[model samples]
Target: MEIVTTIRREVLTLPAAHLGPDNPLPPLRPLDETHRVEDRDKEDLPRDMARQIDYAPLHSLLPVRVRDGYDRRREPRPIDTLVIENDRLRVTVLPGLGGRIGSLVHRPTGRELLYRNPVFQPANFALNGAWFSGGIEWNIGATGHTALSCSPVHAARVPAPDGGRMLRLWEWERLRDLPFQVDLWLPEGSDFLYVGVRIRNPHEKPVPTYWWSNIAVPEDCRVLAPAEEAWQFGYERRLRRVPVPVHDGTDRTYPRNSTYAADYFYEVPERRRRWIAALDADGRGLVQTSTDELGGRKLFVWGRGPGGRRWQEWLTEPGTGGYCEIQAGLARTQLEHVRLEAGGEVSWMEAYGPFDARPDGEWTGVLRAAEDRLEAVLPRADVDAARTAWQPYADTEPGERLATGSGWGALEVLRAGWKLPGTPFDESTLGEEQQPWLHLLRAGSLPEPPDSRPPGGTLVARHWRDQLETAPATPLTEYHLGVAQWHAGDRAQAVRSWERGLRHAPVRWPVLRCLAVADQEARHPERAAERYAQAFDDLGRVRREAGDDDGSWTAVTAALGREAVEALLAVGRTGDARSVWQRLDPATRERGRFRLIEAGLLLAEGRREEARAVFDAGFEVADLREGDEVIGRLWGALTDEPLPEHHDFRMRPTP
Candidate 1:
């Protein structure tokens, strides 16, 4: 069969020659041994419980990628690029790269609706690290780039019921042990694309999962949504309610005035139809809307500052100014906030297309006009007709089923029974493990203590102490004991326990992390810095040995190294802090928190001109008091004046 290559609308697959061994995608790291459990029967459990409960291995773990010594010279390589188009809209998908929509073009205007990266560049960004920025990335399973991102998936071209064509991408996520598929349908004469997603748990056991479709558009675009309130986590990690569209009397829809990067998750008003759009000044932009099938619309803005600009460079090639993400999810917020049940499945359909603003209209008016246009573009008949034709594709059998069409084999067309997404299912939520303390102890890698309901921190610490006295000091037991001691206000004892654990289990990253925190709290900056640095090194060694090098582990180590820098700065070790800052990846330093630290270091070195330049590059200092103190100290350091007595120049970096 001859492959069609034309401007006419069609779905065609092309080979991706850019991916190879020298620049291979990051591999998924296995669950940490502390969290791994062979079986509950192997532990000293009650006889009745041991006989009745069958504990399956918690295989669906957090996805971690290790990126140490990664090759940055790799060019973009897509396994297969599927192009679907109509006269007004054209979309390109890279099935191998997490089935991401590589590019979407408004054909009539010849403008790209999505931020199309010239290359497939994976960076240490997502929660799991190794996230590619441009285009639309499908995040399934855990919150970060789903385990499938940067991995190949099953793809096929199927006939659309509307006499057009559809491209299907399906993958079995090993970690979640669930199957998910996304079908991109382009009808014969439609200007918009219909996206149908289905996630099913084929196992008898219940699974927890998340589904988020992330759409990237131009950074400076204004976001218009039907929301009056939003949910955001503050610097202290506390969730707070704030006004949507505007916060603190400032419109958040536009990025120009913001001083800091922020993520706003909105509780979209309950309505039959919900929509969100990112539009340029001319009113030409991308719009996304869905039926009640999906909820939780969000806007992730990266401010147009030095840190944001540096991140854009890190995420993509130069000249493609940073882009903002308009995300839609299935749950209230992120993945950890929701779960899926056994034999249960969730399905949803969403529409994406281009819209033009009304002439001489303000942003609010333009938004209302866009909504009116969307209502007309996405009618009930069109949605129902597409759903009627696409139901069979989503209702396929669990695994290895024959997908009859287009001369494709069963294996080539349908793949199923992959891992489910998200963290391990809480056993306490099960029938047998009802004891709260027992569940906590088991999850923490500790044996059931004498008192299942240890009411207070003191009691918990005593129980852990008794267990340590009776049993050998293994890394897990020591770490748990240290946590209990810390909770009981025995910081010194906790430090000792962590130190002892490190001596016995020298490579335990968790123990080192605990020790570092304890040192920091105890005002031992030097010791804290040392412990953090050691932990960073230990994580790197483990990643190398496991051959799981990617951004996930790199993110952890980079964070630890940043903590070390902060500790060094606290003790006035400017030279050491500068050395550590310089050693960080340029991309990591480009983050807002690190940029501030870099400027402080330059100020400490008496390079006033360089420090001023860094400050002028746009720093998102949210706390006015802290910002003032830092500035005051820099001034005092340069001059011979004494610094203010109450001012604390050292500040913890915000993520």
Candidate 2:
């Protein structure tokens, strides 16, 4: 089949006569095709949003020529080199400058290109650097000044004693070359870059070194990765950190959005390699992975700033510049060393492509299979424990402060909202946060709830109250009673129950969360903020003492804090919101998605077009597919839409 693709600068279009090894430039081999279509609206999006949507096509781009050259002049004045050719592409070699390519020149198959390469300045960091060689202007001195110099490092391959062998290929050349050539074939309009490093251990005493690529991804893009869990440890102390409970007692009002700063550094115990995907402005997404040579580098799915929430968790932008990096020769800054042999070599491998929803399953499937295979080969004790820790619970005692319920186990009776058996979330009250379920009860508004009088309502209430009244009461039981009353629509009564519960158990995060959520929904965000702040502080203390590493819970607490703060903002509590955000770690504050969503909410409340812009911006930063579980969650919060289908909302096993 004929492949229609964009040739940015056809790497090789030389006649068959130029195919020999003696040729100075290597023939471009077949790289993958670009699948994007110019128009997407005409495409039929899958009815199932969970289904990956394929909106465009990818045209395979290939390399047609290959060549290599070395500077022949001797070392008295360390040799520097330049290439001048009328061919499809040109190459220049600068020795000892650093691990980076000294110079490169690419000329379109039929055009004369005379573009100069951008200079590299350390102060002005750059994610990538490139040059156009054929028809562009030339000035070596100027190029040197502008071009950033990578640290001088030795590569595996060094020039031969004789000049015939023009280039010294690094051991990792085989791995890097293919992807490098492939990236050049990316469709127009999408922005991407590939950087390769050659780590050469010159000393007999091997010392561990870390390699990092500061990929300059688009400012507004979402990142996707499949990891067991994420960390919330902040690199800096002042940076906001999530406050998860190390032992017990967490607030209920905290919102639980996925993305945050605080430096998420994760290591997959079962699998060494990981992959990350990102969607750009044009609805295009890319997936990148680490190669075996790197022996499975830990995946770092990170982006920071108040705008960070939008970029890392679920944001999406097809044409933006977010990137997935493959660092082969290093480990995280403070981890164990990967000892290399005397003649050792370290290489990293990764792959990326446009974000097509349909292909995502296949792409993710491959990673899972690979991870499974790795796990099978390398049995890890930590992996099992981590999995166990993340497992969902099946049942809790009557008075237990339930973090989550199975299906609608807790909401079997709908005093004011409709419930499908076993599903506690309301069919009619779909778009509100979990806090609203309890708030509705406290407000004495159960008349409209479906199944409000489920058979065991009175018994359950009595059971909860009994637990709360027990001497040395379980704060958990009181917390649940407060929830039940709130749902019963007796706002004052619910508060009384919570206040009583707090008196019995003040440090319970759930109690604080429930009360704060109630207050916020009741239009008193200031009071809610205070409670949330206190709950978070207490929770943070627990995490620090226990040395908790997982950030999911901390993220959950932060979400609650943000929710109350956002609510306060809505009620003209800008000062309160500002104060809450100010206390947040710089990373949390910089989460773009959360900020944009907050801004969107503010705009929506104000009835402005900026709300739409904020929504679009939020979408760009979200890692959403056509259909995702989160879509249901968002719909429930944004609109009073019922779930399209019912799944047991039961708080069964998490897996």
| Deviation (Å) of 547 in candidate 1 | 17
Candidate 2 CA-lDDT value = 0.32
Q: Cα lDDT of all candidates, in order?
A: 0.58, 0.32
- Where does candidate 2 have its weakest 10-residue lDDT segment? 175-184
Mark the 10 consecutive residues where model 1 has the least summed lDDT.
404-413
TM-scores vs. true structure, each candidate: 0.58, 0.27
Say which candidate scores most in TM-score: 1
Task: Report clashes for each candidate as comma-separated counts.
Answer: 14, 120
lDDT of 2 by residue, 132-246 (tens): 1111111111101112122111222211112111122111111111100000111122121122223433223443333433222333333344443332322221211122211
The candidate that achieves the highest lDDT relative to the unseen native structure = 1
Candidate 2, residue 224: the lDDT equals: 41
How far in Å is the alpha carbon of 577 misplaced in model 1?
17
RMSD of each: 13.6, 27.7
